[model samples]
Target: MTHILMIEDDPLILGPTVRALTAQGFHVSQAMDGAAGVQHAIDDKPDLIILDILLPNLDGWEVCKAIRQRSTVPILMLTALSDEIDRILGLELGADDYLTKPFSMRELLARIKALLRRVEMDLQQGRQTDRVQVRDLVLDLGMRQVTKNGVELSLRYKEFELLSLLMFHAGQAVSRAEIFDQVWGTDWLGDMRTLDVHIRWLREKLEEDPSAPELIQTVRGVGYRFTAT
Candidate 1:
């Protein structure tokens, strides 16, 4: 059974959510505060985490940073804050996905399943190729590491996946729709800005100059193309 750690303070929300996930055949673990959540993540090593922004002891952002420092376990952040900046901040801090409060259970389930599926797909693909080299950029798929010009680059989970997809289809124009469907899963209903942000992040790491990105070129009115040369 897939194990999930949920860090939510509100018992009202936590009780039902855990029960629902349990019914869906998931092994659920709970943490009422961010500090405990961080500990559970390190100790339990759950397959995925459902983290809330509002918590006692430590905030969700701190917990996220702590987890990212140690593990690459997929994270889905839940927040009552609707501001785009908050959402972007979470993404920048390495959250795989984010959802606002008042979200339906059905939508939440879809996102969870999508995130899990994406991880599984990545692992399966990793087994096929040990490494991929394009110009000065080298991707060690098995190690889930990337280096540009012999310098290792720190990439979040989504960023790594985005680069992997582009590299897999090097020199080909990959449509925005195809990328979203493949990376984030077809069930994702979130804004497309998520993809835009990830692309920018990839450029910053992969391109010598993010302003004049030559490695991952944006195709006008379409999506992006990865130029190996």
Candidate 2:
């Protein structure tokens, strides 16, 4: 049984959503507040988390940061706000995906399925002992950690995925479309800017100078290419 932790305060939304997910054969755990949500996430170790932005105690953002610091579990953030800043911030904070509130059961389920599918694919595809080294940066596939000059770098879930993909095909121009399909999945419903944002974040972490990046260079008409140093 796939365990899912949902942290949502509104009973009306939480109750129905939980029931609906249970009907789909998922073991659902519910939390009405952000603090309880974080606790459940840590103690229960769910396969996925559905977190709402507005909540009592710590907000969803804080809860996300807390969880990201410890675990790499996939997070699907639910928000009433549609601002671009909110979406970008959620991504930066380590959310795997975001869905706006007032969504139908069909849409919610689709998003959940897509995220779960991506997770399964990620787990099954990688080699157990694979390690990629480009210059001073080292990515350990088994451990899912990146180190620069022997120092590990803190990378969000998507950031690590994006970086790995780029480094795997170093010196090749990976098109934007190909990258979106590979990293975000073919069923991705997010904005195009999502990739650009992730790329920028990776550059900030991996590059010696983000303003003038030497590694992970942008192709004029294509996408990005990670130049092996």
Candidate 3:
């Protein structure tokens, strides 16, 4: 059974979520504060995490950052802060997905299933020829590792997938729609800014100057193109 850790402070939200998830047959672990959430994430290492942004003891951003420092566990952030900046910030802090409050339980379940499905697909792909080298950067798909100049990079799951897709089609302009369909899936209802955020993150890790990236170049009016340059 897939284990899920839910870090939510509100009984109104937590109670129903736990019940629903349990009914769906997922082994659930609960935490009522951000600090406990982080500790549970470390000690239990759940397959996926449902995190709330306005957490006590520590905010969701801090908890997400702390967890990312150690593991690449898929995190889905829940919050009432629905501003575009807040959503982007959550993704930047390494949350894999974000959900606003007043969301339907059906949508939540769908997102969880999608995230888990993506992980499984990635695992299966890892069993194939998994290593690809573009210039000095080396990506080992089987190992879910990326290294440049022999130094490993700390990339979130989406970041790694984005890099892999771009590198696989090096020198070709991959359209935004194509990227969304491939990386986030065809069912993705999130903001288009998600792609831009991941791209910036990739540049930060791979380029000598993210402000003037040479490897992952914007194709203006289209999408992005990756080059061995």
By lDDT: ranked, best first: 2, 3, 1
TM-score of 2: 0.95
Could you tell me how far off, in angstroms, the CA of residue 10 lies in candidate 1 after the best superposition? 1.1
Give the per-residue Cα lDDT of candidate 2 at 207: 80
Candidate 1's TM-score: 0.93
Please provide, for model 2 over 66-116, each residue's C-alpha lDDT reduced to its tens digit, 9 standing for 90 to 100.
Answer: 999989898999999999999999988888889998899999889889988
Looking at model 3, residue 23 earns an lDDT score of: 99
Give the per-residue lDDT digits (tens) of candidate 1, residues 109-213: 988998898889767654467788999989887788999889899888888888988898889999999998878878676667899899988888777799999
Span of ten consecutive residues with least summed lDDT in model 2: 121-130
RMSD of each: 1.7, 1.4, 1.6
lDDT of 3 by residue, 4-33 (tens): 999999999999999999999999999999
lDDT of the structure predicted as candidate 2: 0.91
* Native-to-model Cα distance after best TM-score fit, residue 203 in candidate 3, in Å: 0.8
